[model samples]
Target: MDSRVANDDVSYSSEAAISRWKFAVSRQYQHLLDKSTPHVLHRWIGCFAVACIYVLRVYTVQGFYIVSYGLGIYILNLLIGFLSPQVDPEIHDGPGLPTRGSDEFRPFVRRLPEFKFWYSITKAFCIAFVMTFFSAFDVPVFWPVLLFYWVVLFTLTMRRQISHMIKYRYVPFSFGKQRYNGKRASAESTSLPVD
Candidate 1:
């Protein structure tokens, strides 16, 4: 797959060029995430702080054209997961629904992995929040109305999502790392003693 998923705004013509960039960027990006992943509580707390700051700024300044657009995009991304089946229909999911006996051997793969989904949303909000400070982004509109609409949209979207999850029996979140036992029986290990 193209590293277009990583940075969608940028595009490369050649697969080789994209792969080279992916390899280089993933190492650095993975290192950053590895350092931060351990601090789960801190991460959530930081996210909350960023959100509160955004709300407070928007409330005080009454500027939310960019913020509203960002929220729309964010909600659309969330809706994508709710609408999509946990197991991708496109890929012939080799084994049937992964269960205890068959699941261990099967790789816990997903079409839209959780980390990428989250990173995109977080990046969007952060960029939008930064945009709030710039006067150019502030169009003269009643921000409270926009905020109200967002809240209503969020509620309706989540309500349907909960029902869909219950009906489908699928979880959108990825738990801890999927265990992959790579040990293989070599020819030497299986060969009989030569006498």
Candidate 2:
């Protein structure tokens, strides 16, 4: 009887340990997914919506206001980014991954951060609101025309951005570096061998 009781206790403890390990792993995966995939998707969606609204109406008073607000918020965000330290001291001390020396030398990408997505959405809505007031939707502007124009602009901008990113292997998010640096980089890399 004593042996049986000891064996049962050991089994129970082992089961509890396995359950705890599974829970920890699940939580970790969730954190990684939240940080990477969903964050990027949200940003792209917000930007796309805003672009759509902009192309639909060129001269919206509300669009102007929303754009102003977004610009203000974006400027404030950039200021905060400039003021904040590049590295998080607390993260360094915590059990997070060690920073690579290469990471320090990399340029900051101007990609919109997660927090700014809401502001972008608000900006889109404001632009849409202005269009509604102006009856821009009633205008003979085809939806495809707006979508195609936006796509072309977006593609051109993204291509330039990607080209710059590939050449420098860095994204410049600072005020001075925010604009697409690809044309300059491409002009410079003309001498390099293409794969």
> Which regions in candidate 1 have their CA more than 4 angstroms from the true location?
1-30, 79-85, 88-112, 171-195
Residue 122, candidate 1: C-alpha displacement in angstroms: 2.7
RMSD of 1: 12.6
Clashes, model 2: 1
Q: Could you tell me which 10 consecutive residues in candidate 1 have the lowest summed lDDT?
A: 99-108
| Cα-based lDDT at residue 15, candidate 1 | 67
lDDT of each: 0.65, 0.54
Q: Write the per-residue lDDT of candidate 2 for residues 1-195, one digit (tens) a residue.
A: 999999999999999999999999999976865675556666567566766666465453323333334444454455344333344333445332224544434444333554554554555456554645554344454445555655575567557545644543443345554355888988987878779
Writing each residue's lDDT as its tens digit, candidate 1 over 1-195 gives 566675554544466688989999999998998787667667667767776877787778766765666677575766576455656533655653444553544443455555555556566668878888788888787656776777787788778767755654455555664554435446556778989
Model 1 local distance difference test score: 0.65
